[model samples]
Target: MDFLRWTLIFLVLALVSAALGFGGFAADFAYIGKILFFIFLVLFIVGLIFGRGRGRTL
Candidate 1:
């Protein structure tokens, strides 16, 4: 969740910076956001796989 939050924050910052014409900063922020998003995706997948094996009740 934190990764997703940071990914969104950086993505929004990237868009805003790009709109304001800060090309370099926007690229960096976008790169960071992309990486964080992937990390979140991988973690979510792993959690789903392992979590299903637990068979815990809600």
Candidate 2:
């Protein structure tokens, strides 16, 4: 949940930075967004892996 929140924040920051022509800031936020996205992806995959073993799948 926290990761998703930060990811969304960084994504919005990246977009705003890009629109404002803050290339460095945009890149930084983009990088952060990518990291957070991957973190969420991994968590999701892990959840799926464990989820399938249980009767309740998310």
Candidate 1 — what's its lDDT? 0.98
Model 2 misplacement above 4 A: none
Give, for candidate 2, the lowest lDDT window spanning 10 residues: 49-58
What is the per-residue lDDT of model 1 for residues 1-58, given as tens digits with 9 covering 90 to 100?
A: 8999999999999999999999999999999999999999999999999898887689
Q: Write down the worst ten-residue block by lDDT for model 1.
A: 48-57
> Which ranges of candidate 1 are over 4 A from the true structure?
none
For all predictions, the C-alpha RMSD in Å is: 0.9, 2.5
Q: Whole-model Cα lDDT per candidate?
A: 0.98, 0.93
Per-candidate TM vs. native? 0.94, 0.84
The candidate that wins on TM-score is 1
RMSD of 1: 0.9
* Shift of residue 35 alpha carbon in model 2, Å: 0.6
